[model samples]
Target: MTLYQLHAKQRLPISKQEAWDFLSDPKNLKVITPDHMGFHILSGADRNMYQGQIIQYIVKPFPMVSTKWVTEITHVKDGGYFVDEQRFGPYALWHHKHFIKEIPGGVEMEDIVDYKLPMGFLGDLVHPFMVKKQLQKIFKYREAKLIELFGKMEKEENYLVLRKI
Candidate 1:
């Protein structure tokens, strides 16, 4: 099976605690995500993030297509990093890790997502034109939303890279 990985990094002019507080709260995900995605938490998001926590949501990844996504917060290290894996979602496999570190004047946040689509060959064929592009747009929107919420670090450019693994 072909597994795709997405790596994104951004530096924010905020304290580690500040970044942790905002990111650790599940509700803030909607704030950072694009509105057109129709992302909404169904349950398991009333409290702060913790290991074993399960969050359910509805997302419209494509026009006229809505799906339920359930993810488990598999790992969490206070103020450092956390991992969330798909329990029930569109992808055949989804493993995402979020990392935060204190930088010179602020905090740097990084995300690594490894996933595989379903339908085998059919999935692979559509990935380049559909799935990959969609993911790129989503992350781009996220990057812009984050910049709007918390000012960016001076002269530091955020980046996102997707590759096969």
Candidate 2:
């Protein structure tokens, strides 16, 4: 089995509390997500994020292909970090961790997602050509949306890295 990991970090000119408030709220996901993805919350996102919280959504990852995705908020540490695991989704496995910390003039948010594609070897074959690129595009859109919502840090460069583990 081939497991892929995507690591993304961005620094925004906002307070730690501000970042935590926005990131911890499940509803804000739609704001950061690309509109082209046709992402919508089906349920389990009415209140604040908590452990064992389950959120369901409908996403169109590809044209004419809509899928239901359910994820559980497995762990949450207030303003520090949180973890979400896929209960049902397109991927064979998905474990995502989000972390935020106070930086010099603002806060730095980091995301690490470890996932495995379905269909075994066939999944591996398409990773480089399709899945990887799609994920990169999503993260790029997220970064841009974040910067638009909360101003970017001056002269700071954020990064995204996707690799096999």
Candidate 3:
């Protein structure tokens, strides 16, 4: 069982509270996610996030196969950070952390995901060619959509920066 990690950070032209409000809402996930992935939240998300919140969704991670995913929000800090873990999903283990902090111009949002596949050796073998690439593409799409929605400020070396005017 090999664990893979992915980290992504983005600077948004908004306050920490605003960033938390958006990301903490499970429904907003479809907005940032690519449409082809068929991201949809099956849980009631009309209220603010709290620990023990369980969210379900159906996603087509593969070409034609639809996979049901269930995740639980385990930890949440009002305007700072939150953690979500997979209760039942494609991955054998899925733990994601979202962090938001007030920066000079706006807010810095960071995502950290640690996941492991079900099939041990086979999963590791296919990860590089398929799983990893797919995740990268998904995250890239999300980054582009966010830039489009919030407007880009300056293109730094690695992270996308959005400044408030």
Candidate 4:
């Protein structure tokens, strides 16, 4: 299986603790995701994240097809980083890492995802046309949603500037 990696980063005008508090809670995912994706938490999302935490959700990744996804929070470092791996999902494999660091004016959050599709060559063939575009769209929606919620912190030349919303 060939693993595909996706990386996304954004700077927000918020504290590291605030970013951690929001991102570590699985319930907040639907808030940042696009509504058309039908992302909804089914269980284990009402509390704070912990190592070995399992979150279940129902998502309509394709039209008229509802899929059940289960992921486990395998590793977590308070206010720093966390790793989530798919236990049962559409993908053959999914390992995602979330990182947050306090930057000059706020916090910089980063996401790194490594995933592989189920049908091997067939999946690879469709990836560029389908999966890759879908993932990119998801992350783009997430970035805009985050900026809407916390405003944006941008580096202007030699300094970081916090844009007021």
Estimate candidate 1's alpha-carbon lDDT, on a 0 to 1 scale. 0.95
Of candidates 3 and 1, the better by lDDT: 1
Q: Write model 4 residue lDDT over 1-165, tens digit each, in one string.
A: 677888777888899999999998888999988888899999999799999899999998877888999999999999999999999989999889999988889988878888889998998888887888788788888888988898876762212111111
In the range 57-161, model 2's lDDT, one tens digit per residue, is 999887788999999999999999999999999999999999999989999899999999999999999999889999999999999999999988997779999
**Candidate 2 steric clashes:** 0
Q: State the C-alpha lDDT per candidate.
A: 0.95, 0.95, 0.81, 0.84
Cα lDDT of model 1 by residue, 1-165, tens digit: 689999999999999999999999999999988888899999999999999999999999998999999999999999999999999989999999999999899999999999999999999999999999999999999989888999889978689999999
Query: What stretches of model 3 exceed 4 Å from their correct place?
Result: 155-165
Write down the TM-score of every candidate. Answer: 0.98, 0.98, 0.91, 0.92
Model 2 deviation from the true structure expressed as Cα RMSD, one decimal place: 0.6
In model 3, the worst 10-residue window by lDDT is 156-165
Query: Number of backbone collisions per candidate, in order?
Result: 0, 0, 0, 0
Q: How accurate is candidate 2 locally (lDDT)?
A: 0.95
Candidate 4 segments whose C-alpha is farther than 4 A from its true place = 156-165
